[model samples]
Target chain A: MMNLSRRDTLRLGGVAIAALTIAPARARAETEALIKEFAGGKTPKNAGLTLDIPLAAENANAVPVTIRLDDRFSGARSCEEFLLVAERNPIPEACRFKFSPAMGMADVTTRIRLAESQTVVALARMSDGEILVRRVSVTVTVGGCNG
Target chain B: MLNRRTFIAAGAATVAAAPAIAAPVAVTSTTMLKPKGKKPRIVIAGGGWGGLSAARHLHAQGADAEVVVLERNPIFWSLPMSNKWLIDVLNTDYLLHDMIGPSRKYGYELVQTEVTGIERDKKIVRTSQGQIDYDFLIVAGGIRNGYDAWFGNDEKAIEFTRRAYPSGYTADAEHVAIKNKIHNFKGGTMVMTLPPPPHRCPPSPYERACVMAWYFKKNKIPAKIVILDPKPRIMPIGGGFKAAFDELYPDIIQHIPNAKVKEVDPFNKKIVTTAAEVKFDDAILMPPHQAADMVWRADLIGKTADGKPTTWAEIHPTMLHAKEDPNVYLVGDVMGAVSKQFGYYPKSAHVANYIGKIVAIYIAQRLKGQEVKTLLPDNLCYMMVSGEPKEAISVQFDYEIMPDGTISQKQIDIDIRSADLVEEDHKWAQRMYGDFLA
Candidate 1:
């Protein structure tokens, strides 16, 4: 096990306590509703969804993120809708990406605004009725929003 | 009463009689080729600090010159304020502004085009769009990373992709990778390699390490940022950077001087240096850089001893191209003059703006069939050491032309760590950017 110094322990404890205190029941329900709306009531398997984000973002204003899906976009079956949500942002829905089969890949790269250090979820719905979900926890030292 | 024609006839007669004594006059006439119309056609390539400064200066002089600036990048990135972005003090947006909008304000044409080559004989610049002719061409495209052959094969090495970040130095994609790599780092060495001299922002790598170490300490990340520099001393602002590094983040950073990265063992995260084989959890390698692709493609660039295109362009004391063509001039990082290489030497937008004014004067004199005058450029570089806003330093200098037509510097150091310096830096940035961008 890695040894945690006094400062490290305090920082970790502060982050953990903040997470516990901020994970309100309302936010959880809103996130659940968003996921459902994103997937049309279908729960997606998280295995095929790959989320690429920094473990820690120096500035919260613009964090580069890439969402890659392993699902194949064949004839009539494509990644139609994708949504990005952060647990801490006032506006939970950061952005939405819409794509079609003719666009080739189910990969998108962009810089999103993060409010705080929290888990970000990217949910995608395919034309074949398959839902994909990916989550990455980014520790934002300074909030990018409201600055 | 002597009219303008009589003065011209007398000048021509004097030039024809005493060629050696009137050499300066003849050279002046060549520079002062008047435009057919009221406004002279000036085409500038590269919208970096130098090119923007030239465009702004031409506009400020109120010269009858139709200035057209061709920059590959759509936006202008501020090098001075970029350090704040690395430390999370400033957003990327704070360091970037629209180059096109500023060009319009300055009454210059901003064309987004990739310069292919320059036909010096034909006095034409060949771009991807089409060939553009100019009475005078100012090249200020800035530098590009040459990572080919540094890490085994180019394909094997992680290709550097530049994304549109507010700060031009640190791209969005690169910052994401660096942040992720640094955060996940646990009790291992981290290396930040500095490229050889004549690169942009000399003290930047050291400043980067300072900020990174600050974050490491704040987050309690058990990692040390070891800086590998080829130069014997910390660059441009050597004393100030050394003082800050020692006084602030000494425990978090290990300095390795006179060392160059020989090879990289990517699988093991080990870099073979001239001194020793050091291993690291993450590495931020800044390879050697050269003039932009367009500059290297042109024959106007100065060559190194090994025949590679050195970022430096050899020029007359007046800052015009020494040979190949007299109408073309180089400024900023690519000027090939020794003083321009120093980061603290007026490489900032403020200084570039002044240099542009000098270039405009030279061009205007040449257009009027008059003698072109030698320019003495002012150097000013402002640096931000930390986010506390008190740890900034600004260096100012005035160039003195030497007997051999080279420029020697007269240096003035101002510590901006005080409250007054901070305000000065901000004011200077505002004033310079307004003038240049306008």
Candidate 2:
């Protein structure tokens, strides 16, 4: 299960990056475009929303992800819809969760299926025409016996 | 697993498990860690791996002295291979042992009390119970969490962080809390942070992460374990650990490189790192670490003529004696054992136990008016990579001390993960405990 190739001696503060099957450029661009379309064609700022997704999904069948509107985002930037997109999936659009200011905290915690190695992007369209976003890289690979 | 019979059988078992330890290089200590007094009283401060090694050796040789061990904990907690205790639902019997057995067997008086201060000027060790005098002191008190950099002047925040999410690297109670957290994980993401370098058990957090990932996956839980590493990559056996993350638990483990924990929001379950602000359902926060408080009071940490400081104690790499005081030795994670060929020495129990014995021998020789040699410690660390398949990886380091006082290093990494290595992992801990305690 392991390779003994006489790897580099251990160093501090950093280690070698493991190679992973990366999604194609075209697919990534399309995924970003889908995220943009969901944000009403506006580029989302990196600040307001946090998209917490697994760096790798053992079971791509149902990968759990959490999207939260940061408390720093005032009521003026309240999100209406939060869209999740998987770049390398056959269907890039996973689903969108509707949120309301009445809900107090606009957030979504759900699972979405992903195919090959891809990037998961979450976008939120605020009430004031401002958009917020976050992206996480999920390396979809074969999991353990059960996963 | 070591009962009375196993204690009697420890010698043969040592021969069966380990090849003979290499020659030792050491110098004398007077007042810090253990108890060997006749011509000279050698006081050891802590009852950790390093302290016990020195205590056992000094008393067993009957170095014509009264041997005593000043320990804080009533029981001894074995850290070697204790990572399994975090993920698997298991009793601590394997990791915990009665200190009385080793103390009685070795004929070292065990003082179970907290060390309040080390009065270096008077050569007196002030404990919670009382004060003890020493000719030489071994300050093997281990490391203290350096949370000042992260939460400066914020005692409430620090207290909250320690209670809510402990790194479980040092204390026995924290390990039990984390083990329960793993066993009864409700759902959502679990986070574990890796300290920068020179932390105790370099590969431990990684191995523990791997084991927990395997546990979550095996149990069919849709849980993700995010590893926020201060380092840019997995360290020590980097490639081997990286491979395990890539192949075995790629989906279950999220390793964010260069994510040094800068701020911790305990109430909100969030931590701001150099790279990202992470929000976790639960997290094991590994606060930055420095030598124990006793060392600071003793003025052992490297300091300018004024009062600037380094985290670890400044000690001779080979001799392990504090650069300022030859009689006051520092061992274990407390000392900065940097090598010329390598960087900081691996702060593993193997190295601690080995260096402890060496330090004791030096004190013994000095007590008898004999010369001491300059020997270095060898270290071997085993990490369990998976649980279902029961695979593990190991690393070995053999050191040589040059005439110039520079350390020459040789390392062998058994990077390949195998069931056989996992078997050795358990045996290694057993033999090590048997060696010192039995």
Interface RMSD of each: 24.0, 16.1
When candidate 1 is compared with the true two-chain complex, its DockQ is 0.01
Among the numbered candidates, top TM-score falls to 2
* Alpha-carbon runs more than 4 Å astray in model 2: A1-147, B1-39, B304-307
Tens digit per residue, CA lDDT, model 2, A31-143: 76787577676777998789887686543544668999886346665678888887777667888888767787776676676766667888888888888888888886423
Q: Is the docking of candidate 2 incorrect, acceptable, medium or high quality?
A: incorrect
lDDT of 2 at B395: 71
For candidate 2, the clash count comes to 24
True contacts kept of each: 0.00, 0.00
Model 2: TM-score for chain B: 0.88
For each candidate, what is the lDDT? 0.64, 0.73
Across B1-438, the per-residue lDDT of candidate 2 in tens digits comes to 447545645543222111111112221233223333445667789998988988887875568666567787878887776777776533578788877778778877777667788888888887755567888898888888887878897999888888788777775687777877887887799988777776888338889888888888888888899999886556555657888998998888999998988778888888898888889998888887788988888888886457778778889876789997898998788887465345566777877787787787778878888877666666778899888778888877655555555764545556678889887777777767886877
